[model samples]
Target: MSAGDISLVAGTAGAEVVAVAYRSTTHGEVHATVNGGHFALWFPGDELRDGATEGVQLEATFRDGSTATAVLTLT
Candidate 1:
Protein backbone atom coordinates (compact mmCIF):
# COMPACT_ATOMS: atom_id res chain seq x y z
CA MET A 1 0.00 0.00 0.00
CA SER A 2 1.03 3.59 -0.58
CA ALA A 3 0.20 6.63 1.41
CA GLY A 4 0.13 10.15 0.02
CA ASP A 5 -1.99 13.08 -0.98
CA ILE A 6 -4.04 13.62 -4.12
CA SER A 7 -5.18 16.87 -5.60
CA LEU A 8 -7.72 17.80 -8.27
CA VAL A 9 -9.61 20.73 -9.61
CA ALA A 10 -13.31 20.68 -8.87
CA GLY A 11 -13.94 23.21 -11.61
CA THR A 12 -17.28 24.20 -10.11
CA ALA A 13 -19.21 24.58 -6.94
CA GLY A 14 -21.39 22.16 -4.99
CA ALA A 15 -18.87 19.44 -5.70
CA GLU A 16 -17.83 17.51 -2.70
CA VAL A 17 -15.34 14.71 -3.13
CA VAL A 18 -16.78 11.76 -1.29
CA ALA A 19 -14.42 8.92 -1.97
CA VAL A 20 -11.24 7.84 -3.66
CA ALA A 21 -9.96 4.42 -4.59
CA TYR A 22 -6.81 3.13 -6.17
CA ARG A 23 -6.99 -0.06 -8.11
CA SER A 24 -9.01 -2.45 -5.95
CA THR A 25 -7.98 -0.74 -2.76
CA THR A 26 -10.30 1.79 -1.17
CA HIS A 27 -8.80 4.81 0.54
CA GLY A 28 -10.23 6.32 3.67
CA GLU A 29 -12.51 9.30 3.22
CA VAL A 30 -10.64 12.54 3.60
CA HIS A 31 -12.70 15.67 3.91
CA ALA A 32 -12.54 17.54 0.63
CA THR A 33 -13.43 21.12 -0.02
CA VAL A 34 -13.35 23.30 -3.09
CA ASN A 35 -12.06 26.80 -2.83
CA GLY A 36 -11.45 28.75 -6.00
CA GLY A 37 -12.45 25.70 -8.02
CA HIS A 38 -9.95 23.39 -6.41
CA PHE A 39 -9.69 20.91 -3.56
CA ALA A 40 -7.39 18.21 -2.23
CA LEU A 41 -7.66 14.88 -0.50
CA TRP A 42 -5.29 12.55 1.22
CA PHE A 43 -4.66 8.84 0.83
CA PRO A 44 -2.70 8.75 4.03
CA GLY A 45 -0.15 5.95 4.36
CA ASP A 46 -0.41 2.34 3.21
CA GLU A 47 -3.85 2.42 1.60
CA LEU A 48 -3.28 3.01 -2.09
CA ARG A 49 -0.70 0.94 -3.82
CA ASP A 50 0.01 -2.10 -5.91
CA GLY A 51 3.76 -1.72 -6.26
CA ALA A 52 3.42 0.11 -9.53
CA THR A 53 5.60 3.04 -10.39
CA GLU A 54 3.16 4.32 -12.96
CA GLY A 55 -0.28 3.90 -14.45
CA VAL A 56 -2.05 3.52 -11.15
CA GLN A 57 -5.75 4.21 -11.43
CA LEU A 58 -7.69 6.45 -9.07
CA GLU A 59 -11.44 6.83 -9.09
CA ALA A 60 -13.17 9.62 -7.24
CA THR A 61 -16.82 9.92 -6.40
CA PHE A 62 -18.66 13.13 -5.72
CA ARG A 63 -21.66 13.94 -3.63
CA ASP A 64 -23.62 15.13 -6.62
CA GLY A 65 -23.77 11.71 -8.19
CA SER A 66 -20.75 12.43 -10.28
CA THR A 67 -17.52 10.52 -10.68
CA ALA A 68 -14.03 11.19 -11.93
CA THR A 69 -11.31 8.76 -12.84
CA ALA A 70 -7.61 9.38 -13.11
CA VAL A 71 -4.24 7.66 -13.28
CA LEU A 72 -0.87 8.53 -11.82
CA THR A 73 2.30 7.23 -10.25
CA LEU A 74 2.26 5.95 -6.70
CA THR A 75 5.24 6.55 -4.55
Candidate 2:
Protein backbone atom coordinates (compact mmCIF):
# COMPACT_ATOMS: atom_id res chain seq x y z
CA MET A 1 0.00 0.00 0.00
CA SER A 2 1.07 3.54 -0.55
CA ALA A 3 2.08 5.69 2.41
CA GLY A 4 -0.97 7.83 1.86
CA ASP A 5 -3.14 4.89 2.85
CA ILE A 6 -1.98 5.04 6.43
CA SER A 7 -2.92 7.67 8.97
CA LEU A 8 -2.02 8.04 12.63
CA VAL A 9 -3.72 9.70 15.52
CA ALA A 10 -2.22 10.74 18.81
CA GLY A 11 -3.64 9.33 22.00
CA THR A 12 -3.77 12.70 23.64
CA ALA A 13 -5.63 15.50 21.98
CA GLY A 14 -3.77 18.77 21.38
CA ALA A 15 -0.46 16.94 21.54
CA GLU A 16 2.08 17.73 18.89
CA VAL A 17 3.57 14.80 17.07
CA VAL A 18 7.31 14.67 17.30
CA ALA A 19 8.38 11.66 15.31
CA VAL A 20 7.44 8.36 13.76
CA ALA A 21 9.85 5.47 13.64
CA TYR A 22 9.57 2.25 11.69
CA ARG A 23 11.78 -0.79 12.00
CA SER A 24 14.13 1.13 14.25
CA THR A 25 14.62 3.76 11.58
CA THR A 26 13.34 7.24 12.27
CA HIS A 27 11.77 9.06 9.35
CA GLY A 28 12.19 12.80 9.04
CA GLU A 29 9.49 15.07 10.41
CA VAL A 30 8.79 16.20 6.87
CA HIS A 31 7.16 12.86 6.21
CA ALA A 32 4.75 13.30 9.06
CA THR A 33 2.38 16.20 9.36
CA VAL A 34 0.47 16.83 12.55
CA ASN A 35 -3.07 18.13 12.37
CA GLY A 36 -4.84 18.53 15.65
CA GLY A 37 -4.88 15.05 17.22
CA HIS A 38 -4.07 13.22 14.02
CA PHE A 39 -1.20 12.91 11.61
CA ALA A 40 -0.31 11.14 8.38
CA LEU A 41 3.07 9.51 7.71
CA TRP A 42 4.55 8.79 4.34
CA PHE A 43 7.03 5.97 4.10
CA PRO A 44 9.22 5.01 1.22
CA GLY A 45 7.75 2.19 -0.82
CA ASP A 46 10.88 0.07 -0.50
CA GLU A 47 10.77 0.27 3.27
CA LEU A 48 7.59 -1.73 3.36
CA ARG A 49 9.00 -4.90 1.76
CA ASP A 50 6.09 -5.07 -0.66
CA GLY A 51 5.41 -8.79 -0.93
CA ALA A 52 6.65 -9.97 2.41
CA THR A 53 4.52 -10.87 5.35
CA GLU A 54 5.82 -9.02 8.35
CA GLY A 55 4.82 -7.08 11.35
CA VAL A 56 6.38 -3.68 11.51
CA GLN A 57 6.40 -1.57 14.60
CA LEU A 58 5.43 2.06 14.37
CA GLU A 59 6.44 4.26 17.27
CA ALA A 60 4.95 7.71 17.62
CA THR A 61 6.20 10.40 19.94
CA PHE A 62 4.18 13.38 20.97
CA ARG A 63 5.30 16.75 22.30
CA ASP A 64 3.34 16.06 25.47
CA GLY A 65 5.95 13.45 26.47
CA SER A 66 3.66 10.58 25.61
CA THR A 67 4.44 7.82 23.15
CA ALA A 68 2.41 5.17 21.39
CA THR A 69 3.26 2.11 19.37
CA ALA A 70 1.33 -0.01 16.92
CA VAL A 71 2.17 -3.09 14.93
CA LEU A 72 1.04 -3.37 11.34
CA THR A 73 1.19 -6.69 9.62
CA LEU A 74 1.49 -6.58 5.91
CA THR A 75 0.90 -9.43 3.59
Candidate 3:
Protein backbone atom coordinates (compact mmCIF):
# COMPACT_ATOMS: atom_id res chain seq x y z
CA MET A 1 0.00 0.00 0.00
CA SER A 2 1.19 3.46 -0.84
CA ALA A 3 1.56 6.10 1.85
CA GLY A 4 -1.07 8.11 0.01
CA ASP A 5 -3.63 5.51 1.02
CA ILE A 6 -2.61 5.59 4.66
CA SER A 7 -4.56 7.84 6.98
CA LEU A 8 -5.06 8.63 10.65
CA VAL A 9 -8.51 9.56 11.85
CA ALA A 10 -8.57 11.64 14.99
CA GLY A 11 -11.28 13.61 16.71
CA THR A 12 -12.17 17.24 16.16
CA ALA A 13 -9.55 19.95 16.51
CA GLY A 14 -8.05 20.45 19.94
CA ALA A 15 -4.56 19.88 18.65
CA GLU A 16 -3.31 20.52 15.19
CA VAL A 17 -1.84 17.32 13.90
CA VAL A 18 1.17 18.39 11.92
CA ALA A 19 2.36 15.05 10.60
CA VAL A 20 2.33 11.29 10.88
CA ALA A 21 5.49 9.22 11.15
CA TYR A 22 6.22 5.56 10.48
CA ARG A 23 9.09 3.18 10.94
CA SER A 24 9.53 -0.35 9.70
CA THR A 25 10.64 -3.08 12.05
CA THR A 26 12.70 -4.94 9.51
CA HIS A 27 15.99 -4.77 7.76
CA GLY A 28 16.85 -1.52 5.95
CA GLU A 29 14.97 0.27 8.68
CA VAL A 30 12.83 2.48 6.56
CA HIS A 31 11.25 5.59 8.01
CA ALA A 32 8.67 7.94 6.60
CA THR A 33 6.93 11.16 7.48
CA VAL A 34 3.68 12.18 5.87
CA ASN A 35 1.53 15.24 5.98
CA GLY A 36 -1.24 15.22 8.58
CA GLY A 37 -3.79 14.60 5.88
CA HIS A 38 -3.88 11.69 3.45
CA PHE A 39 -0.57 10.98 1.71
CA ALA A 40 1.53 8.26 0.11
CA LEU A 41 4.96 6.68 0.73
CA TRP A 42 6.73 5.10 -2.17
CA PHE A 43 10.10 3.37 -2.07
CA PRO A 44 11.43 2.74 -5.52
CA GLY A 45 12.69 -0.75 -6.42
CA ASP A 46 11.44 -2.22 -3.18
CA GLU A 47 7.96 -3.47 -2.59
CA LEU A 48 6.66 -3.13 0.93
CA ARG A 49 7.21 -6.56 2.42
CA ASP A 50 4.21 -8.72 2.95
CA GLY A 51 3.40 -9.30 6.62
CA ALA A 52 6.05 -6.77 7.58
CA THR A 53 4.48 -4.97 10.46
CA GLU A 54 5.16 -1.31 11.04
CA GLY A 55 4.79 0.76 14.15
CA VAL A 56 3.07 4.09 13.73
CA GLN A 57 3.24 6.79 16.38
CA LEU A 58 1.62 10.18 16.28
CA GLU A 59 2.68 13.33 18.10
CA ALA A 60 0.35 16.15 18.89
CA THR A 61 0.59 19.11 21.20
CA PHE A 62 -2.69 20.76 22.10
CA ARG A 63 -3.46 24.39 22.58
CA ASP A 64 -4.47 23.63 26.13
CA GLY A 65 -1.01 22.60 27.31
CA SER A 66 -1.88 18.98 26.73
CA THR A 67 -0.37 16.26 24.54
CA ALA A 68 -1.81 13.20 22.88
CA THR A 69 -0.55 10.17 21.04
CA ALA A 70 -2.07 7.48 18.87
CA VAL A 71 -0.36 4.22 18.13
CA LEU A 72 -1.18 2.14 15.09
CA THR A 73 -0.07 -1.16 13.70
CA LEU A 74 0.25 -1.75 9.99
CA THR A 75 0.61 -5.03 8.21
User: What range of 10 consecutive residues in model 2 has the weakest lDDT sum?
Assistant: 5-14
Candidate 1 local accuracy as lDDT? 0.50
Clashing pairs in 1: none
Find the 10 residues in a row with the least total lDDT in model 3. 6-15
Higher-TM-score candidate among 2 and 3?
2
lDDT against true structure, model 3: 0.41
* TM-score sort, best first: 2, 1, 3
TM-score of each: 0.39, 0.42, 0.29
In order, the Cα lDDT scores of the candidates are: 0.50, 0.53, 0.41
> What lDDT would candidate 2 get against the real structure?
0.53
lDDT, residue 51, model 3: 23
Off by over 4 Å in 1: 1-15, 25-52
- As for candidate 3, its clashing pairs are 3-39, 3-40, 3-41, 4-39, 4-40
| Alpha-carbon RMSD of each model | 6.7, 6.1, 7.2
lDDT of 3 by residue, 1-75 (tens): 553433332333222444433344333433234344433333443334332365455454444556566664445
Residue 52 alpha-carbon offset, candidate 3, angstroms: 7.7
True-structure RMSD for candidate 1: 6.7
lDDT of 3 at 3: 36
- Give the higher-lDDT candidate: 1 or 2: 2
